[model samples]
Every structure is written in C-alpha cells, then in structure tokens.
Target: MHVPHHPAFPKAPRLPAASLPLALAIPLLLTACGQKPGEAGHGMMMPPTEVSIVTVTPKEVPIEFEYVGQIAGSREVEVRSRVSGLIEKRLFTEGNRIKAGQALYQIDPAPFAAQLAAAEADEAMAKARLAQAERDLTRLKPLIEAKATSQKEADDATSAVDIAKAALKAAEARRTAAKLDMDHAVVTAPMDGVIGKTLKEQGSLVSAQGDSLLATMAQTNPAHVQFGVAEAEQGRVQQELASGELKLADKGFNVKVLLSNGSVYRETGHLDFSDYKADPATGTYAARASLANPDGKLAPGQFVRVLLMGASRPAALVVPQRSVLEGPTGKYVYVVGKGKDGNPAAEPRPVVVGDWVRLDGEVKNGWVIKQGLKAGDQVIVDGVARIFMPGTPVKPVAAGAQSAPPAPAAKS
Candidate 1:
C-alpha cells in the first residue's frame, strides 16, 4: 500500500510486541476519558439530586430530658439489735417483705430475763425497807409529840425514810431498764419494707455498741428514683427558661421511667425533690421522683432511665438531627431554596441549636433551632449525602413521598 506523508507529520517508530498492546489501548483510553461513566457524552450535565425536605413551621413542641437514674426505696433502714445478745433464731425469711414492728430475729433472752428477775427482787427488797422506814417514822412522830421519844430520834427516822425513798427510785429505774432490754432481745423491723439477707447468722453475738447490724430493709411502695442533673445542663436550662424559650408545667415535671428491658414503667411519677447544692462527687444537682409502686415492681438499687416531661418549646423551629451538619465554621443545614435561575437548590444555612428534642408521635430526636431559620423554610431531611457542594441544584420532595424522576439530561 502506498502512503503519503508530509514533512510536518513525522512517521511513527515501530513498537515492540509488549508496547504494541499499550499503544493500541491509548486511543480507547482517550475516548473513555473524554466522557464520564454515567454521562451520555461530552458536555452533558448531571441531573439535579432528589432530596426529601421538611417545611419549617412554628408549633408548640413537647420537650423531654433523659438522665441515668437509680431506683431506691422511699426509706432505707438498717436493722440492728438494740441490746447485746446472741441471735437465737431468724424470725423472718430473707428477701421477703416485712411489716413495721414485725419480728425479724429472736435474740437470746435468757440473760435479759435473769437480769429482770434480779431487778424485781431488788425492787421488792427496797419496798420492804421503805415500808419499815415509814412505820418507824410514823411511830416516832407520835412519840416525839407526846414527849415519849427525843426530837433527835424522830429526825433520824425521817432521814432514814428519805434515804429509803431514794433507794426505791434507783431500784425502779434499774428494773425498767432490765425490762426494756428483755423486750429488745427480739429484734423487729422498724418499718414496712423488703428485708435483705441477715447479716448476723443464728447464734451470732451482736452488741449495741458495734456489730449491731442484723439486716437491711427498704420501703418499696412509693418508690423513689434518684438522678442527677449536670451543673452545666442546669445552667443552660435556666437560661432557656429565663429567655422564654422553654416553658415548664405549672405543677412540675411529670416523670416516667424506662426499665432495663427497654419498656416504659406502668406508673408515672412526679418530681419530689431537687437539691440546691451540687454534689461534690458528681458535680451534679441531685433530684428525685416519687412513683407509686403498689405492686412492688420497682426494686431498690435498680438502674433505670428517667424521662422528665412537662416542658415544651413554644413556636419553635426544629429539624431532624441528621440534617444538621458540622462544617468548618459551625453547624449548618441544607435548605432547599430557589437558585438564581429559579431552580431548586441546596444552600448551607448556619443555625444555632438550643437543645435536642423529640417531636410528638416521633421516635427519633431532632434539634431545636434557636436561630438562623424562619417558618416556611424548606429544610432537607434526607438525601443530604447527594449534595456535594453548597448551592447545588436539587429536586425538593416532601418527606416520605415518592421521589420525582431526575430532570432530563441537558442536550449537548
């Protein structure tokens, strides 16, 4: 074959076998590089991304705060022996509900009984001596008045009577103490509660001075939930309340509990107490809620999640938490607005968020927008990943709606 070549175009050198494959691939690679994989050809533009959006509207939204809490009894008491003695028997079953004044342990009463008997005998002897002193004084009074006995003798008899009276009082006091000790030998529950295991076993010697703890009991009815609020969080809430951004219920917060199994407690509670001083250990203010636990479902020392309700944000703007993105400047959200060409576009809008809130009838949480957003602004809730850059044109679709087809590709 005859080929003509001009001086301006040089003849190509022959490639080796290995280099020939690469040489042949150069043209195909150049053709592939000229057009994007998904594009029909060069200069064809990609369709606008489809995104789900929520319209911003000012409405009263209920706000809830959650904290890690623990279940506790309204009253916890340590069962101890009031008198020193050996534990004769365990009267109450371990881990059982007990009533106030119910006998829990029977301490050895033999020694107490013996002491009481001795006191009674001493009291009886004192009574006899007192009677004799009174009789002698009575006899001396008449004798002295009739001049049958000396005045000194009558005075001595009266002194003896006074001494006897003092002795009697001392004996009576001892006897009463002995009787009380005898009664205390039987240890009883101080309040109605669920009793824990006995600390002192049978035949264990317990004393009032030390080692007196026999068991522990806690009142389960009207169960109390103890939780802490961080000092920073408290301050933030106060500021919000002061600015009229948050409104609390007139009564107080209505509390609900989340069990470990992820179920809500049947009974609701109310805020009973909140400490003014911060806890030294936790740097949080202590708060408590009281709930009716008639069925004894709540146990002491159980961990739970506390939900504090009865607060709401009035006429506030909110968006899904996922919609808020953190950029180099601050937190922002993509808002669907009209571009210069009158097409829908995603624009980055900086926002100041106050608190995380769960909307009514919604499971997921949302951010309460404090600033930089107004009512009727369309905020993109989903498909934000598709927005590669600010001011990217988008197809706005209502949340939970069928997505519209992508705009037809622009003709080259």
Candidate 2:
C-alpha cells in the first residue's frame, strides 16, 4: 500500500518494537514529573475542599455589672466606757453573739458603791433638816399673825427656817450627782451584735477618753459591703437605673458577693445607699449593700466582688465562656453561615462587649454576617484553634468524629 507523509510510515526503516515501547514510556514519565503534586497523572485537577465550622447564635442577652467591694458589718461599734475606771470583769465572752443593752463589762463597784452610800446618807440628813424647817416655819407663821413676840423676832425665825431649807436642797443635789456617777460604773452594749477582740482585760484602767478600747461589736445578721464605681461609668449606670434595665423591687437590688477563691457568699444582700458626691481621691462613687450574714461568713474590711442580679431575664441566652476568643484590639468569633449551595461557610465577625453577663457575654454591638448563620446555629467549641480560618477550604472533622466506639461489655 502507498504510505502518506506520516512519520509512522516514513520511508526510513522502522525501529524495533522494544524501542517503540521505550519511546512511549519516556513521554509518560515526563508528563508525570511535570504535573503538580495534587493533580493526577492524567492531568485531572483537585476540587476545593469543605471544612467543618461553627456558627454564632443570637438570643436575648440580659446584661449585668460586677464590681469589687469590701465586706463590713451593717452596725459595727467599738465598746468603750462612758466614765474612767478600772475594768473589774468582762461579762460577755469574746467572739460570742450578744444582745442589745447587754452588760459587757463591770467596773470597780467599790468606788461607785461608796459614793452612792454617801449620797444616801446625805439625802436622809437633808430630809430631817427639811422636816425641822417646816415645823419652825409653822410656828413662826402663827407668831407673826398673833404678834406674841415682836414682828422683827418672827421675821428672824422665818429667815432661819428658809436657810435650813436651802441647806437641805444643797445636800439633795449632791446625792443626785452621786447616784448618776454610780450608774456609769457598769458598761452595757448599745446594740445587738457579735463581740470581737478584747483590748482591756480585768484590772485594766480605762478612761472615758482613754485610747484603750474595751472591744468591738459587729451586727452579723445584716452585713454591709462598700464598693466603688468609676466616675466615667456613671452615665451607663444612670441609664440602667432610669430605663429600668435594673429592676429593683419594692426593696432594692439583690446583690451577690464573690470571694477571692471564687466561692459565692451564702447570703444575698441589698443595695442600701450611694454617696452623693464622687470620691475626691479615687474619682469613683461609693456604694453600700446590706448583706445577710446569718452564718457570719462575712465581716468588715473583707475584700470581695459584688454582682447585682435582682431582675430576671428568662429569654436571655447563656453561652459558655470558651466559645469566644479575645484579641488586643477587640473581641471576635468565626461564625458558619450557609452559602448559596446550602453549605456552611465560616466568616470572621467582630463584636463589642460589655461587662461579662454571667455564663454568656454581652454583645454591646451587633455582629454582621453574609453566610448561613442563624439564631440557632451550631458552633464548634472544642476544635476551635485547629480549623478556624476565614475564606479557606478545609477537610473538617468534628471534635471527636473518628474516635472508636466503646466495645460492649462481656455478656454475663
């Protein structure tokens, strides 16, 4: 047959069949070497990947404010003596609860007793003198009327009676003063509370103005907490109050105290009062809360944190703190939104945050998303650091997607 101008049927003699196989293999190997790592030997391209992602959910979020404060007794007083004397005995045991008007200490009764006794004696003598004066006056009045003696003599007798009456009045005044001095010998508690350390022991001399204090008494039932709020944040607090963001009942706000070890106090307190003017030194306002201390867990000068949670926001959504990530500039999260194809797509959205609102945080500013995120979207909380990337495709695996299932226990 006649051959056309093709290389396969060239006029030159054909190579061996082995050489032909080799020539074909060389082009095939070259093609494999020239291809990208991901592309197959046939020049097929790899498709975009699909990654697993989480979405942010939106719900009513009730906002609250937390502050650091101090625990104090609602009614705290230092027990001291009204008059100067030696402390004879301390009646109430230290660190024990006492009642109002309870006698706490007894001064030396000897001095006070002697003074009262002397006053009584003086009072008795004054009465005797007054009796004699009355009798003399009675006699003088009749003498003056009858002129039995000279009018001048009767007048002198009346004057003498008046002088005796004046002497009795003077003696009676001394007795009253002595009795008052005696009553001050026994010191009593002004109010009901728990007694604290005793500064003066038996035989210790205490004066009315003595630097030495007898002891301290603190009301344990309703304790007080002193807290400070920054001056700049006044506007936010005012708005919350005026707008009823914080709903105080007929009483006031319900307060919770947090200790340094993160334990909640047993009792709830109420917001008692606020300072009229800002503190000149701190540039913050002082606030006081009355806390119940039935167990006496809190005391004055103890530092703690305060939470105001009187209102109820049942519609609010609470999320675990681990779901959110923080940055130096602000806070942000990766939310999975549905693409046109109904596939989940992750997008980075920034948010403004307010005071931490319990389990979930406050979104002071709203978050914007163009993808499939919705109110009830699911978020990947566990595998966050591994696969969170914006506009990137990934072969995503849920936190424990491939873990082997636990084998069933051996049949009994």
Candidate 3:
C-alpha cells in the first residue's frame, strides 16, 4: 500500500544493538579512569574534630548561698490621732525624716480649749467652797468647845469641809483630763523615722475610737532584710552547725546584701531572727538580717538578694561550666581518654554538680563538682556537640583556642 512519508519516520536510522552498548560503556570507563588515586567512590574521609579541654583542678571554694529577700524598716509604726477632732493643718512634710515627738498634724483645738476653760472654772468654784467650809469649821469648832454652839453644829461644819475637799479633788482631775485631750489634738510622731503621706487631709474628721491612721513612719537605718530559707537548706545548716563545720556569731550568721542591680551593699549584716517552724505552704522558714543603712539607701519593701557567707569547703573539684552536659542518666562531661592506635577519644563521665560560682554579675565561671570527677583529668570544655559517640576520636587543644581548619590537599 502507498503510505504518506511522515516527518517523524524519515528522521534517522538506528545503530546496531551491539555497537550501542559499546558506546555507553566507553563514557563509563572514562569516568572511572578520571578519579584521583586513593579517593572513595562516594564521599571523602573527614579529619578528626578539634576540641578544647580543661584539666580538672581541686580548689578550696567558699560555700555560699544566695536567696531573694526584701528590705524593711527596723521599726515601723502607724501614726494615729488619740482624740476625735477635725484636722486643722498638716504640720510635717511628707517623706521627711523626723525625730521623736515631731509634730505631724494639727487637729482643731477650739472645742478642746473651751472644755479646758469650763474645767478650770469648776475647779476654781470648788476651791472657793472649800475655803468657806474650812473657815466655818474653824469658827464652829471653837464655839462648840466653849459651849457657845451645839455639838450638832460643829459636826455639820466638819462634814461640810470633808465634802468640799472631795469636790475640789474631782474638779482637779477633770481639769487634768481636759488638758491631756488638748495636747493630744496635735498629732506627733511616736519615734524617730521618715514619715509617709498623710492619710487624712486637713478639714477631715478623725477619731480615736476608729484608730484613724494619720500617716505611717518607719526607721529604715539599720534596715531589716527579710528572707525565707528553704526547709531542706535550713536543716542542712543546722546539721552543719551541730557538726562544727560552720561557725556563727551569737546572734546568727553574717550575710552580704546584693542589690537587684547586682551591686554589693557597702555594709555587712547579721542574721537576728529565724522562725522556729517552717511554713507549710512554701516549705520555708522566715528569717531576717539587720543591715546598716545609715544613709537610708535601703528602703522598706525593697527587693534584694542575700548571700550567706562565712562557710567554705577545704577541697572541691571544679570544672568550667561549659564542660557539663545533660544526658539521659543526668549530667555528664566528656573526658579525653586513650583510644585505638593511641588516638585521643571522648569518654562520658557522669557527675553530680552543686551550686555554680559566678564570675561577673551572674555570669557562670565554673561548677562545684560533687562526684564522678578527679583532679588532673582532662574535660572537654568546647566542641562537645560534634561528639556523636562516647569513643569518638577528638583532637584535644587548650581551652579557649580556636580550632584549626582542615589541612590543604597535598600537591601532586
């Protein structure tokens, strides 16, 4: 049959199947021969990883504990009025340091003054009556003795004198009470302290029965720093105390105050009070330290840190904090050990760590090694993440050195 010449069919002629296989094999042979000597078919061998190591050192580390605390006044009292009256004027500036008996507020004294005046008038009347009764008695007594007056008259005069004396005494007592009330109208500070804002302003009615709080005052010098100690720590401290490992003054342990900004207070403090019982809610015991704050730098209710000092460990194994690693079994550190062919390898050593020693403002310097480490052992401080196995080969270098790069290829 006559068929139309299609463009796709008239394109080209195919080669022999045997020759096709030979052509593909030629390219494969060239690729295989082009490979460099001693090279792997897939990937190249990686050089040993470089790591930093630190030799373990035993030190006499000072044992200290830090706890959050708050500053408070050594003595704090609420200023209140003793009598019911209207506040006439503010007598002291807010937040000003004051001495004991310093006037803080003035209540209206007009009513109290009038009451005192009435009491004085009554006392004067009583005195006049007493004088008259005494004169009558004197005259009646002589008259009765001389038979000029009856015995009943002399007895009545004596009774009148006694009544007059009682009246005078009562009037004088009232007068004293009135004077006290007048003096109380002027509110004064109970102790030397810094006064807070006045709660009741001028023209406000105040009373003694309700204990109207006029203001608050606090003695902040020698400030009281209040803190809480965990129950576990408290027990440990007691145990150490009994063992004579820690020595404390008669008052208590000496402490250092660290402000929130990481500055140490100029003055040292002494622990004065500790609760006998632990708080059930927080499992802590309330404690207080008295710190000298003559400049009033520490104020009431200021948050701070308290560092318990004056204790230490004679021999403590420590390592750079960076060497510590957390694993399934707990904390561990990579220690350099001899491997096959005398090559160095990383071996994991389990460790128990205590509190950290800070360098500058909370920066970690090293860790207190409680267990699983000894002096002179080398610990991997850097490049720990690259270690996949316990016996992985590593090139040890001094801590803080930069890892050298891979060597260049050898010249042909």
By summed lDDT, the worst window of 10 consecutive residues in model 1 runs over: 1-10
For model 3, the run of ten residues with the poorest summed lDDT? 3-12
Q: Write the per-residue lDDT of candidate 1 for residues 1-412, one digit (tens) a residue.
A: 4344422223445678999888777567656688434455544466788999999999888889999999999999899899998899999899999999998989899999999999999999999999999998887877888999887888899999999999999999999999999999988889988999888899899989988999899999999999999999999999989999889989879999999999899999999999999999989999999999998989999999999999999888988898898866688888988888789999878899977887645474788898989999999999888775666789898998996455898799
Candidate 2 local lDDT, 1-412, one digit each (tens): 4534422111336779879988677667667688544445643543334434343454444444689998878888888787778888889888888999999889887887898798889878878877887787787787678877787777777777788778778888888777776877888888988999898999999878756478988886788888998987777667765875444455557888989898888877778798989999999999998877877788678899998765433333333445556655455555555545455555455544444455423333322232323465554444455432453333344433654455888799
TM-score leaderboard ranking: 1, 3, 2
lDDT of 3 by residue, 1-412 (tens): 4334432123224678978988677557656777554354544444567899988887666567889999999999999999999999998889989999988889999999999999999999999999999999887876788999887888899999999999999999999999999999998889998888889998999989995998999999889999999999989878976876545555446889988788889899888898999999999999999988888889898999998776655567878888887765588888999877578998788899986875235555888888889999999988887876666789999987776666898899
* Full-model lDDT for every candidate: 0.88, 0.68, 0.84
User: Residue 120 lDDT in model 1?
Assistant: 96
What is the clash tally of candidate 1? 0
| Predicted candidate 2, C-alpha RMSD | 13.3
Clashes of 3: 0
How big is the RMSD of model 3?
Answer: 13.2
Best by TM-score: 1
Q: Which parts of model 2 are misplaced by more than 4 Å?
A: 1-59, 149-166, 209-212, 239-252, 311-320, 327-329, 338-343, 359-388, 393-412
